[model samples]
Target: MHKYVKAERERQAQRYRARPHYEQRVNFSVGDYVLRSRVDEKLHANKLRVMWVGPYRVVGSADYYFTVEHLINGRTMDVHPSRLKMYADDSLNVTEELIDHIASQGTLLAVEAIVEYRMNSDMRAYEVKVKWLGLETVEDSWEPLKTMSEDVPQLLLQYATTTSDDVFRRAVTTAIDSKQSQRSTRR
Candidate 1:
């Protein structure tokens, strides 16, 4: 019985060594640059779409996740290893093209401040002129208040109180309150 058990153990060890290693971790060190897989709903529909978005720099790592920061916007995200691929291009043209592609894909830019606000009669929605970080005033554009409430509720609330217009204040307050309630329920 002991000889039979020993043979079975040896066979199991041999099978383990021979089998494919699909569970192997993709090792990434701090300072290594990588690209993250783009997870858009329209990915398969558009054959020409750029799949991977970033050339993010790995800043930190835990057991099964790595913290990567976007090179352009400095946005940090904790991503699984399978979603990341090494970015090794050092050419200036390739980098420029990649940046342009990311911008075209509607990458989230940080909002610096709410410069001004107005009601859009055409859309029947309140719009706020946004000042984006690292961009000039010339690039500022109008964004919907409902969208702003979700993205920057505190900023919208702060701006709402500063305004004397009752209509704008009420609209912004309602949007913020709804957003807060939705968030609380999710928690």
Candidate 2:
């Protein structure tokens, strides 16, 4: 009896051990939205100070890896499948034009626009206005302000506000023109 019990126990253990561990694969595509997990580490004070802070959009993807855009600091990052959860929607399909308009506008336009403009420019100053949905409307009329510089090109002076000389202007203009020419040629 004792021998039979021991053998049964061993058999059970072997069966349990033989079972394969299952891991789910999360596949994300470009433009599909996802969230990024944040890290919190007191031990590494200089490393991370927050935890799980995003419902970011998925910008790119590899086999099992995904790139998510974290909106907290306007950064896009890569994450593994284990760190994501699906976004839930509880509503049925309603084909209202107003609903479509609202959805297209999104909830975080002001924040994203500001971040994008700041990241893309090094010197140009911008004034931004954020209006709440239905509370205010945007007017569509404006002439862009132009700055005058006799010795320097206006575009160069826009970048190097402190410098005012033909040499600086020529160098900056040449660099910009070369870049534009290259881009045109590529197209």
Clashes of each: 0, 0
Segments in model 1 whose C-alpha atoms lie over 4 Å from true places: 1-21, 25-32, 38-51, 59-65, 89-94, 133-136, 178-187
For model 1 the TM-score comes to 0.65
The C-alpha lDDT values of all candidates are 0.83, 0.46
Tens-digit lDDT track of model 2 for 12-127: 98887777644454655566555445455643575545344445666777876788764333456678877766542223232466344434432332211111011113434321
Worst 10 residues of 1 by lDDT: 88-97
Flag regions of model 2 displaced more than 4 Å.
Answer: 1-21, 43-50, 72-74, 88-187
Report the C-alpha lDDT of model 1 over 20-110, residue by residue, as the tens digit: 7735657778888788876566447664454687777888999889999877667689998888988763332446777666556656588
TM-score of each: 0.65, 0.32
Identify the leading candidate in terms of lDDT: 1
